[model samples]
Structure formats: C-alpha cells, structure tokens
Target chain A: AQSVTQLDSQVPVFEEAPVELRCNYSSSVSVYLFWYVQYPNQGLQLLLKYLSGSTLVESINGFEAEFNKSQTSFHLRKPSVHISDTAEYFCAVSRPGGYQKVTFGTGTKLQVIP
Target chain B: EAGVAQSPRYKIIEKRQSVAFWCNPISGHATLYWYQQILGQGPKLLIQFQNNGVVDDSQLPKDRFSAERLKGVDSTLKIQPAKLEDSAVYLCASSLVDSGHNEQFFGPGTRLTVL
Candidate 1:
C-alpha cells in the first residue's frame, strides 16, 4: 500500500517570492509520482510527473519538483510566484504494477499576495 | 480534443435521499475513474474501470455508493441514503488505455451537498 503526506496545509507568499510545498510518500515498491494543481472551481490539472530517468521534473509554468528516493520526498518548488499562482496543489503516487490506483495527499493551498 | 464532461454541476439532497451523477470521458479513452474530494483534501479514488469492466473499487462505500461505466464510455455514480460526510466534489477522469504515462484528463467535478 502507498500513502502520500503533504506537510503543509497552507502557505502564504508575497508576489515574486520563492515557495516550496513539501510532500512525502510511503511505499514498499516502485511508484510513479505526480503533482497536480487545482484552481478555484476547476478540475485538477497535471503539473508534472516523475516516472523514470530524471529525478527532477518541471512544468511549463515555471514550477518544478524533485523526486528524492532516499528521502521518500517529492517536493514542489517555484523560484518566484505570482498572484495568479494561488491555488491548491496535490501530490499523488501510483504503484508500478497493474491495477495502479493513484493515492493523493491532503493538498496544500498556496496563497500569493500581491 | 474535448475533455471529460459531467452533468449536474451541483446537487443538494437530504440525508436518506438518493442522487446520481453522470460522466462522459474523452473520446477513445478506455480508462475512466471516479473520485471523491472533500474540502481541504485531495481527491480520493472511489472506483476505476477499464473498458467497462471493474478494475478497483477498494475505497468505495459499497453499502451506499455504487458506480458503473457501461459500454466503456459514459459512466454514472449513485449514492443511496447519503450521509452528511458524503458531501464532497465527485470528480471523473479518463486516460488512454495502456498508455505508459498515466496522464488523466479530468472533468469539472459535480459538487454534492448532503443536507
């Protein structure tokens, strides 16, 4: 069984400030990691994912996350944030084998103040 | 391509009443999923279907909640005798079958309020 934990429930940042959302998971087998963003009243949109190859993954919107296997962490980061970046972020993990059910963390709400 | 579609964007029903929600996945996708998202929480998978066959429904509250993906296309979810705790957003997502990368396209969820 796999479970995801997002350490922060809320994070407030001033415009142009850097921010990081911490996420950790527990799994006994290989898994796929993903980050999703949900804007107000909208469905979740994929931000990025880490399947294999590089441990670091990036999104077009200047957001990035690094998958740390040893630490069992997949933290999302952005060097600078804009007011438009305020939204909810979620971390999810899926098992490697068939019947891959993705389990998500209790999201982190990002508030970017102008 | 058109994204997933869901009907009755918002629903309010009294406890012990029944409600149903509909979903249509992206064209040609063979994998569809139903999830429940409570306020301040991430989406939790309720059930999954592969080409109209049940795949996983481990977390679904079987006694009150049921779902089906008929003909490997449109799907419907129902809750009978709803509990107040079941008030949450129900999300539907779809993905291409056998795709190495499980990138799911989601629909704007149906928000259910159990009064």
Candidate 2:
C-alpha cells in the first residue's frame, strides 16, 4: 500500500511570484509519481510525471517536479505563476508494474492573486 | 478526440435513496475508472475496469455501491440506500491502456448532494 502526503492544504501567491507545493510518499517499492491540476469547474489534467529516466520532469505550463528518492518527495514548483494558475493540485503515486493502483494526496489549492 | 463524459452534472437526493450516474469514456480507451472526491480531498479510486471486466474495486463500498461496464465503452455506477456521507463528486476517467505510465483523462464529474 502507498500513501501520499501534501503538507500544504492551501497556497497563496501573488502574480509572477514563485510557489512550491510539497508532496511526499510512503511506499515499500519503487513508484511512479504524477502531478495533476484542476482549474475551477474543470476536470483534472496531467501536469507532469516521473516514470524512470531523469529525476527531473516538467510540464509545458512552466511547472516542474523532481523525484527525490532519498527524500521521498516530488514537490511541484514554478518560478513564476500567473493569475490563471489558480487551481487545485494533486500528487499521486503508483507501483511501477502493470496494475497501476494509484494513491492520491489530500490536494493543495493554489491561489494566484493578481 | 472527445473527452470522458459524465451525466447529470449535479444530483440531489435524500439519504437511503438510490441514484445512478453514467459515464462515456474516450472513443478507443480500454480502461475506465470511477473515483469519489469529497470536498477538500483529492479524487479517490473506487473502481477500475479493463474492458468489461473489473480489474480493481478494493476501495468501493460494495454493499451499497455497484458499477458495471457491460460493453466496455460506457459505464454506470449505482448507489443503493445512499448515506449522507456519500455526498461528493463522482468522477469518471479513462486511459488508452491500464499502464503505470499512461495518463488518465477525467470527466467534469457528477456532484451528488445528499440531504
């Protein structure tokens, strides 16, 4: 069984300010990590994912996350945020094999104040 | 290139009532998922189906929650004798395959309000 922990339930940042949403996981085996974003009244969309290759993964929207095995963390970060970036973010984990039984965190609501 | 579709964007029912929600996945997706998202919480997987057969349903409250994907394309989730705690958004998602690296596309979700 795996569990994801998102330390911050809410994050407020001014426009163009940097922000980080912390996430950690506890699993007995190697896992795949993913970040999904949900805008107001919209469904969740995949932001980025860390499968195997390089520890660092990025999304087209200027968001990035690094898979830190030693730290058991996959924190999502963006150097600058726009007002449209206000949304809810969720971190998820799953085993590397076929049956991708994913586990998700409570979620962090990001508020990009203009 | 249609996304996952769910019916009745919002549903209101009383406790102990029965309700059903429908979902139509992407055109060629072979995998479907049902998730429960409570307020302030991330979506939680309740059931996963590979084609018309269930792959995983460990988290589903089988006593009251039942889901089926008869033809493997569309699915329906039913809750009998629903409880107040069942008030939440039910989401439907689909992926081309049931793999660890594949991304899942989600629907807008059906918000169920139990009074």
Candidate 3:
C-alpha cells in the first residue's frame, strides 16, 4: 500500500515571498507523483508531475517540485508567490501495480497575503 | 476540450434517505473514477472504471453504494440509506487512458449534506 503525507495543513506567506509545501510518500514499487491546486468551487487542476525524468519538475506557473528518492519527498516550492496563488494544494502518488489507485494527501491551504 | 462534468452541484437529504449523482466524462476519455472526500481530508477513491468494465471497487461500500458507467461514457452513483458519514463531496474524474502517465481531469464535485 502507498500513502501520501502533507506535513502542513495551512501555510501563510506574504506576497512575493517564497513558499514550500511539504509532501512525503511511501511505496514499495516505482511511483508517479503529482501536485494539484484547487480553487473555491472548482475541481483540482494538475500543477505539476514527476514520472521518470529528472528529479526536479516544474510547472508553467512558476511552481516546481523535486522528487527526492532517498527522503521519499516531493515538496512543492515557488521563489515568489502572488495573491492569486492562494488555494488548496494537494499532493498525490500512484504506485505501480495493484489497481493503480492514486492516493492523495490531506491538502495544504496556501494563503498568500498582501 | 471540455473537462469532466458532474450534476447537482449540491444536495441535502435526511439520513436513511437515498440519493443519486451523475457524471459525464470528457469526450473520448476511456477511464472514469468516483471519489468521496470528507471535510478536511483527502479524496478517497470509491471505484474506478475502464470503459464499461469495473477496474477497481475495493474501497466502495457495496452494501449501500452502487455506481455504473453503462455505455462506457456517462455514469451515475447511488447511495441507499445514507448515513451521516456519507455527507461529503462526491467527485468524478476522467482520464484519457489507464496508463502510467494517466492524468485524470476532475469535475466540480457534488456536495452532499446528510442531515
């Protein structure tokens, strides 16, 4: 069985400041990692993903996540954030084999303040 | 390309009552999934389907919950004798394929409040 853990339930950062949302997972086999952002009343949208490339993956919207194999972590980070970046972020993992069920974290609410 | 669609954005019902929700996946999507998300928690997948066939329903509470993607397109989920714990957002997602690179597109979930 695979599981995802998001250490922080909420993170508040000033506008233009850097932020990080921590994510860790446990799986016996190879895995795929993903980050998703959800706005109020909207469905979750894919922010970025890590499959089989370099450990570091980036999103077009200035967000990036590094897949740390030894630490079993895939933390999302952005050098700077905007007020519009405030949203609920979810970290998910899909382990190979089984039903390929993608397990998600509890979520971290990022609040960008002015 | 349009994303996945779910109906009845919100529904409130009394415990022990029955309720049903609907979902329509993106055009040509071959995989669909149903998830239940409780407040302040992650989404728990109840079932997954590939076309009209069941792929995984290990977490589904079959005693009270049932779902079907009859024609391999749109789908519906039903719950009989709902319990208070069933009050949560039911989400629907669809993917182009059931592969390693599968990127499931989610629909705005249907919030169910059982009184």
Encode model 1's per-residue lDDT on A3-109: one tens digit a residue.
Answer: 99998999999999999999999999888999999999899999999999999999999999999999999999999999999999999998766668888999999
Model 3 clash pairs? none
Off by over 4 Å in 3: A97-99
Q: How well is each residue in B17-83 modelled by candidate 2, as lDDT tens digits?
A: 9999999999999999999999989899999999999999999999999999999899999999999
Residues B1-115, model 1: lDDT tens digits: 8999999999999999999999999999999999999988889999999999999898999999999988889999999989999999999999987343589889999999999
Q: Model 2, residue A7: what's the lDDT?
A: 91
Compose the digit string of candidate 3's lDDT tens values, residues B1-115: 8889999999999999999999999999999999999999989999999999999999999999999999999999999989999999999999988874578899999999999
Ranking by DockQ: 2, 3, 1
User: Among all windows of ten consecutive residues in candidate 2 chain A, which has the lowest summed lDDT?
Assistant: A95-104
| iRMSD for every model | 2.0, 0.9, 1.8
- For model 1, which pairs clash? none
List the DockQ of the predictions in order.
0.59, 0.81, 0.63
- Residue B44 Cα positional deviation in candidate 2, in Å, after optimal superposition: 1.1
Displacement of residue A84 (Cα, Å) in model 1 is 1.3
Best by DockQ: 2
Least accurate stretch of 10 residues (summed lDDT) in model 3 chain B?
B95-104
Q: What tens digits encode model 2's per-residue C-alpha lDDT throughout A1-114?
A: 899999999999999999999999999898999999998887899999999999999999899999999999999999999998999999999888786888889999999898
**Over 4 Å off, model 2:** none
